[model samples]
Target: MRIKLENGKQNELISLAKRNLTWKELAEKLNVSEYYLRTDLFYEKRLLNSEIFTKLSKIIESDFSKFIKLKLEDNWGQKSGGKKSSGRLKKVLKPEKSEELAELIGIILGD
Candidate 1:
């Protein structure tokens, strides 16, 4: 099933998932590369396939239907800016003192 998520709902889901599971664990559960989850899904705002959405819903222990907006149509325009931006991922400096700060940085980098 093709679906469009409500605005910022994907990021919200990712935050919820991170609270309960590490990136590695979530990647394994979704059977996708961690890079893809971090880069494509989180950063690029790619739409989720039905299988992955179902797994993510289960992993986050929430009903996903409320977050879904519409069944995506073939000609559905990009909800993000129409053109893809070109750039390299910025280097993140390691956090010195707090692990929580580090994790938050990681989450932002993923976006």
Candidate 2:
């Protein structure tokens, strides 16, 4: 499962992990791409998977995993299809409107 640490703690952990190594060198040790390590994890931060987080903890000898917590993210994905207008709108609705509808139609028909 993907996990997240508190942002402050995660940044502290990343700083510790960096130590003297450049991101490219650190990524090489972790067998991942520097772009992913730098951009994905370091810059555009998101949930890190268990294995990667474990590796980082081991590499830095720092465990911030306890700071991690699960949240039910309702905003995680997109919702499709929604009411495009203010509902039934100013259009035909009930059978009682048929007389008004016919009058309106007659006006359009040039009657």
Summarize candidate 1's per-residue lDDT along 1-111 as a digit string, tens digits: 556788888777776776867788889988999988987787536877778878878877898788788777544555433444436458899657798887887999994
- Candidate 1 — worst ten consecutive residues by lDDT sum? 79-88
Each candidate: RMSD: 17.6, 9.2
**Residue 36 alpha-carbon offset, candidate 1, angstroms:** 0.7
Clashing pairs in 2: none
Q: Model 2 Cα displacement at 72 (Å)? A: 8.7
> Which ten residues in a row are the worst by lDDT in model 2?
77-86
lDDT of 2 at 30: 73
Candidate maximizing lDDT = 1
Please tell me which predicted candidate would have the highest TM-score against the true structure.
Answer: 1
Residue 55 of model 1, lDDT score: 80
lDDT of 2 by residue, 42-67 (tens): 75276666677788899888667688
Task: List runs of model 2 lying over 4 Å from the truth.
Answer: 71-111
Error of 1 at 47 (Å): 0.3
